[model samples]
Target: MAQTPQQRRANERFAKNEAAKRGRGSTIKPKQVTKSPVSAGWVVVLAFVVCGGLLLELLRIVPELWTSIAAMLSRLTG
Candidate 1:
């Protein structure tokens, strides 16, 4: 079956597009990942600071725990 002029032009345009797509190589470039500004030494220091804070908090709670235990023991004895 003979196509209309418009249909023929559309088919030609489609084939030309397909050929153009096949003729080209990949134009995409690889993405580069950026490293963090903070170094490993800084990370270690931050971890140490956090751990030191936790240790100090634990130390602060120890005296309260001892007082509570003493109160319980006195109540039990009385």
Candidate 2:
């Protein structure tokens, strides 16, 4: 048995309508409020500490930047 093109089109239209109806009535999520001052301060402090540690580790591996600081000064003087 072969399905006609009209039947397939009807089925596709029905599926689209079903999806749109469900999307409109989807569950709503409550807004998240970061209202804790103590926890927020700790979060900001830890972010800076982690970023600073990674930067130092990169500077250790790429020591040329540290050494180049002296070279740059010498070039300026020369």
Candidate 3:
């Protein structure tokens, strides 16, 4: 459903007022922001560990590809 022009204007005004109120505040409430989709250095390290585990499984299935995978990862990182 779409809002009427007047309804949209009222909402815009409300948002502006809310923003101004937030801007004027010196303390109390923290900023409202979305949590990171993937957060922290440790999370990235964990992701790498999971990927390495998957690759290890793949290497066991296709042992001949280990050298190629190592070279690929080295080239990718470098």
Candidate 4:
């Protein structure tokens, strides 16, 4: 059976990949990924900044929250 151009190209790619897997023909190397230690440090810093901001917000709202709770309790009791 005659193969179309696309089918022939696909067959060539398949053969190349198979050859690479078997350590034959032109071997294709996978790209390597390397992470930077500085990036991990920056991630930790960002987490601390976010946590600090949330803590500050909670601290700022505590006084108002206490007032609201006190008023609610007075209404319920008196």
Best by TM-score: 1
The estimated TM-scores of all candidates read 0.55, 0.34, 0.34, 0.49
The lDDT of each candidate is: 0.97, 0.90, 0.90, 0.93
Instruction: Find the number of clashing residue pairs for candidate 2.
Output: 0
Candidate 2 per-residue lDDT over residues 1-78, each given as its tens digit: 887999999999999999999889778899998677578779989999999999998988788886899899999999
Error of 4 at 44 (Å): 1.4
lDDT of 4 by residue, 1-78 (tens): 999999999999999989887885556799999877678779999999999999999999999999999999999999
Ranking by lDDT: 1, 4, 3, 2
Instruction: Give the top-scoring candidate (lDDT).
Output: 1
Question: Which runs of model 1 end up more than 4 angstroms from their true locations?
Answer: 1-17, 69-78
What local lDDT score does residue 54 receive in model 1, on the 0 to 100 scale? 97
